[model samples]
Target: MNQESQKSVEYSQYYNLECRVADQVKAKQYNGALESLLNFITLVMHRQYPPGELIGSAKLDRLCEKIGLSFYHEFYGNIVHRDEFCSNDDVSVIICTGLFKSGGTSPLIGDIVRAQGRRKSTILATNSLGSMSGDDLAMSRLGEVNANIIICDKGNLVDRLHWLVQQITRLEPSRIILLNHHQDSVIIAAARPFTEKTKVLFYHHADHNLCLGVHLTGAIHVDIHNVGFCNCRDREQVADNFYVPMTINDLGSDFVRRVFLDKRRLTTCSSANPHKFSNFYFYPYHELIIDRLEARNGFHIHIGVMPESALQHMHHKMLERSIDPSRLVYIPWTPSLWKALIDNSVDLFIGSFPIGGARTAIEVMGAGVPMLMHENYLTRFHSSRDIAYPDHFLWQYPHEFTEVISNITFDDLQAHGMRSRDYYLKYHCTEKIGLEDELNRICDGTSTTRPAPLYPHHPDMLDRSLHFSYLEDMAIGHSIQHDRATHVAPVAAPLTPHQSVSLSLTQKTSKVIGLLTARTYRNALSLIPWLTKR
Candidate 1:
């Protein structure tokens, strides 16, 4: 073959591999997806450089950009880049995400935009085109708020980074908000040089243990829950950290009353990821609740985002406990379908154990469905507790939880459900939280600023052994011993630019290793069925 033809063929292989990874991600086969991505990166690097040559940040960035662009095109088709719209507009806030999915950070952006009166200039920046069904549904929902959505088409990390930096620099956004852990490094790196001119905020949406050693120094940190703020404060001192509780659009009095009064078959639901229940320790709690609910004549449980294998395992566990399997039902998750279920069928929303469901719980409450949560010490974020639902809705022991489920009368459901709705309206309403005011403060330099932590100067600022052990205990099914060390102390100073870059590099390296390990485990699991069939 001619050299040009050979090059074209190799590039096509990489593009095909990226397409497969995007499909896998959409299918929720994340481990397999990561494996494919890592392999693609390795091959591209090898092709570009001689063997044993160290890959630098510039090359790595270029490779990531190439992969991101291929994935975007494969998923989204040939859509024109909306650079002109974003660049010329006077954008007040910029929210960045790797993908625009139905859950997590995307919805939060929608809420913020909705709360800000929809007139404020806001941008929803994403890396990929997003899954047609799910992402489009999410976009439609966010579209209600009328925010400009921009997807990066630049191939390779460097170009994408430059593109993002250019948008920020050109638009001169008052503040920039990053959505999740996945987009942290690239966004932070791109924004670091411009930090003095603009306020950048990283919102911590998950447990801190999952992303230890992240360089959050250059930007301010925004914790969705107070617990998350405390967690960040305890780990690394930043310029400033804000506790902005997540708010949703109120479902209104009519919907609240209707859902409260609807007394038919009792349906309990959860929209959390199914893998959360895959751990041996947490699955039993779900089974126990389902079993107790099944014993009652009118009660049933509906769970979304659960795979068939996990459902089967839970069913088997229920059977072992002499609980009827018929009560437990698995529902596939889609934005519209889940909302329909919430509005019409769901009676009680059950929050996930160990790691509480913040967004899901808020969503259920916003839809006027009362939620029941176990107040466990192991939960990384006490979202249930933070929401301050009535004491009757919070359970500590297994028997107590079962009793609450069994004894809940029609009146009790109505009263509790209304209370939840009221609480959501008062506390979680977008206007109530003053998102606009906060953004204004951030933009004008009136926002509170604490001394940033100098990690090199203060060694204690980097230590998280106790926190790691606590998370380790939760992961392994061991009981967590809550103590004074868990409390958030006043943060020390901030890290220097050099220190920040070093920390970010360290985290990126650690993430690469973590991804490899996870991919290996998934590959091994895939082998189990083959071995069993033999």
Candidate 2:
């Protein structure tokens, strides 16, 4: 089938499924209903669904209430929006976020907290990675600032949200910061009750896709990059859009950027999580790696943890290219990514493909290693290349990426690497010194205006949106299938034969509901109790 027709078929199928889920929500089937709703939103955010049909926060909030979620029940019923900012509370600040999606060891969240949150504070991690060990740097950073940690990744959405709501009330925090994932709405829902007095600030870390809490009123939308700042304000995401430069942790003043004089051979390395490399079709990464190693003298250091499935896939791709994959050395985890690059004496750093790791790019820039990233979409909003999310290091295709690598001279690497570190200091490091003070000013409510003209950094948002559009029908559909399994297993509904509604073999459903298509016919199946599996 043609691509447009195929996409239409998938959309019709999804809409029919969505109608079934709406019925589940009406029946108050919290377990599967909520999960299905979240999965729909996830599909939309991941670009599997239509962009124009993107679900709104108000609609989702209404869904939460209709699904009989205990948290939203309390949020809508018991909570009042207070206009007064309460500074004299038990905890000065409460920061809530999800650490599950990024799939990296980079301390993006911990870096912000360590840099800004100095008063009595608590770090609440909701829906963490699979029983995260103590090696979590974010938690360790909390220790440096004398902050408390709350791990809340257990139980169903209802139970967890209700539990968190109680915690927020008990803590009586002066301010709340939400670094939640696109699909995780528990943090915002829980913090909604205290929006007036507590004054919520949403830190936009993931801005390239659809996200929850953008419709939050009275909350200050804080953007680390100008790309996010413009997108939110232009789109009217929140009433207040605050510009805040992102900050990284200082690994002492001793680590200096060194010069690279080697030209004949290259030693490249990457530390992005497995997700960025999964099913990347925009470029042939495997062939480039094989060719580089084949024509070079040094090995490619694969730092951080990688799934066995990905490793096997890599090997298979290398075999297809008629090259031995011996030079690709995998290092599972390191105490520090910076120290690892320094230890290996790396020549170049490969930024994560399909999704760039901004923090990893900064680290690479700090270590005097030039970065080459796949320009899937610009996640962060900014005009300058210093924050490391720039066109300078970005590569859009396989051959172009290879050419950039081939054309690299020792002079270019040395000059560019030093410039990278200089910009890192100019844009990121100097700001860290006054990060706490800047955060305090924000808490005091200084930033309350939309200061810039409406113009996105990219020439066309198509550069970013097109990536999701390509995978909408096939890749992201399978992705949602896996997500469904993660939320809950689909089992038979507990309806007895007495409650079952079965149509006679001779009775035509088309007669009952005129002009029903194949997909609409599937939508009708949701009403039959005997056929219901959730």
210, model 1: CA deviation in Å?
A: 4.6
- Please provide TM-scores, in order, for all candidate models, with all chains considered together: 0.61, 0.71
* Model 2 misplaced regions, further than 4 Å: 1-36, 46-58, 61-90, 95-106, 116-118, 128-143, 236-239, 261-264, 313-324, 377-386, 389-391, 430-433, 448-534
lDDT of 1 by residue, 358-396 (tens): 667666666667777765433434324555455437655
Candidate 1 regions with alpha-carbon error over 4 angstroms: 1-89, 115-140, 206-218, 257-265, 280-286, 301-303, 314-326, 334-342, 380-383, 442-534
The lDDT, on a scale of 0 to 1, for candidate 1 is 0.50
Count the clashes in each prediction.
Answer: 10, 3
- Number of the top lDDT candidate: 2
Residue 137: error of model 2 in Å? 8.2
